[model samples]
Target: MKRRDALKNIGAAIGYSAVIPTAFNLLQSCTSEKEKWTPLFFSVDEAIVIKNLVDLILPKTDKTPGALDVNVPQFIDLYAYNVYVEEKLEEYRLSIDSILKALPIPETGAIDLKYEDYDNLLKKYLKASKEEKQQYISDKNITYEALINLRNQSVWAYKTSKTIGKDVLAYDPIPAVQKGCISVEEATGGKAWSL
Candidate 1:
C-alpha cells in the first residue's frame, strides 16, 4: 500500500474506534432503565411511599401521562435529597414518619406503604366524610403529628405535579415557540385575532 494511503487508513481507523464507543455509550445510556436517569435520594422504604404518593397525585390517564410515567417520584426524591437542606430533609422525615404511624397498621415498623394503602389513608383523612374528620378532630383531636404529615405529603405532591408541568412538558415562554409565527393581535373586544 502507498505510505500516504496507509497513514490515511490509520487515521480513519483511529477516528472510527473513538466514535464507536461514544456512540454506543450514548445509545446504551438512552435505553438504560428509568433508574439510570433518576438519582434516588430516598431510602428504599421512603421511595416506596413516595412512589405511591406521586402515583396517587397524578394517576395515569388516557389523555395525559401520569407521575410515574414522568418519574415524578424520582424527581421528588432527588429534590428532597439533593436540593433540600438538612433542616428541610429532617422536617420531611418527621412528617413522613407521622403519616406512616397514622395509617392502620399492625406494627409501626418502617414498612413501605403500597399505593392502595397510601390512597386509602389519604382519602380517609382528606376526602371521606368531612363531618367524621371534624368530629375526630373535635373529639379525639388530630395530633400535631397527623397534621404535619398531611401538610408535608400534600406539599410534596403539589410541588411534584407543578415541576412535571413546567420541566418535563414542552412548555415555553411567549415568543419561544417559533420564529415568525403569526402574532395574535388583540381585537377591540379583547379577543385574539391573527395579524
Candidate 2:
C-alpha cells in the first residue's frame, strides 16, 4: 500500500478501537443491574433504619411513589458518605443510634417499629419550637443537627430522583423564555419544579 493509504488505514483502526470501548462501556452501564447500591458509610442495620425513616417521611400516596420506591435511602447514604466530615459522620452515627435505642429492637437485631412510630417522631421534631428542639437535644445528648441533616438529605434526594423529579414534579426539560414576573402557582400549577 502507498504510505498515505497506510496512514489513513492506521488512523481508522485507532478511531474504531477508541470508539468501540467507549460505546461498550456506555452499553454496559445502561444494561448492568449489578450496579446495585451498597451503602458506603452506613452499616446494614443503620441503612435499614435510614430506609424505614425515609419511607415514613415520604410514604407513597395515590399521587406519587415514596422515598423507598425512589431509592432515597441509598441516595442519602451516598450523599452522607461523600459530603460529611469525620465529626459530622460521628454525630450522625450517634444520632441514628439514639433514635434506634428509643425504639424497640427485635431478636433479629432490626428495629421493631412501624412507619407510624417514625412518623410520630418526625412530627414531634418538626412541630417543636426552636427552644424545645434545643432542649430536647440537650436532654438527649443527641443533636437535632443530625436529624435535620438526614431530613434535608432525604428531601434533596427525593426531589432530585428521576422518579420524583421527572415523573412526579413539574419537569421542563426544554424551558421556554424566562418569565421574570410570573406567579409560582401559575408557572408550575403549585407543583414543585424539578431543579
Candidate 3:
C-alpha cells in the first residue's frame, strides 16, 4: 500500500476505536441506575415515600408479612409508572409530602428525630411488645391514617397496572389458596369456611 494511504487508514482505525469506547461509556452511564423495581409513575422520591408508607400501613406482624416484604412498594412504583394518571401521581406525591413536612426534619433535609424517637411509641408497637404505637397514632393522628390513605391509592394503582398480573400472582396469600378453591377440603363436620 502507498505510505499516505496506509497512514490515512491507520488514523481512521484509531478514530473508530476511540469512538466505540466513548459511545459504549455513554450507553453504560445511561443504562446504569435503572429502575430496580419497575419505577411506578412516581418520581424517585415519591417511590421512597410509597415504600415507607406501605411499611407503616401494612406493618409486618407475627401473623403475616408486611407490604414491604410482599414487594408492595415495587408494585406501587410500577403501577404509578405505567397505569396511573398524571393527576393521581401528583396527588399521591402531595399527600405524602404534606405528612412528611409535618415531621421534624432538619433544614438540610435530614430527619430531626432518631430512628427510635417514639421508643415505647412506635418501635415497641412494631416489635409487638407494646401497643403504644396504636395509641400514639390515634393521639397524634399521623402515620397510620396517612398510610391507610397511601396504601389504598397504592394498592388500587397496583391492581390497575400491568404489573398486577405478575406481582399479585407472586404474592403469597394465606393458605396458598388458588383462584376459587380452598386449599384444604375438610369433610369432617365443617361449616364449609371460605376464609
TM-score for each model: 0.51, 0.68, 0.42
lDDT of each residue in 45-152, candidate 1, tens digit only: 555565565567667777566766655555455445433455656777776666656655435433634556776776766665868776766765443435435445
In candidate 2, which residue ranges exceed 4 Å CA deviation? 1-37, 129-131, 137-143
User: Candidate 2: lDDT of 8?
Assistant: 40
Model 3 per-residue lDDT tens digits across residues 145-174: 454566575454333332333333333335
Q: How many angstroms is residue 40 displaced in model 2 relative to the true structure, after the best TM-score fit?
A: 2.6
> lDDT by residue for model 2 over 1-195, one digit each (tens)?
764344344435675343333322222222113236577778877777787878777789998988777777765665455444567568778878876765566767655656676676677676678898878778764535556767776786677666677888989999977988888899988888886
Candidate 3 segments whose C-alpha is farther than 4 A from its true place: 1-40, 107-146, 153-195
Clashing pairs in 2: none
lDDT of each: 0.51, 0.66, 0.46
Q: Which of the predicted structures, 1 or 3, would earn the higher TM-score when compared with the native? A: 1
Better of 2 and 3 by lDDT: 2
Model 2 clash count equals 0
- Residue 25 local lDDT, model 2: 27
Best by lDDT: 2
Error of 2 at 81 (Å): 2.6
* Residue 92 lDDT, candidate 1, scale 0-100: 70
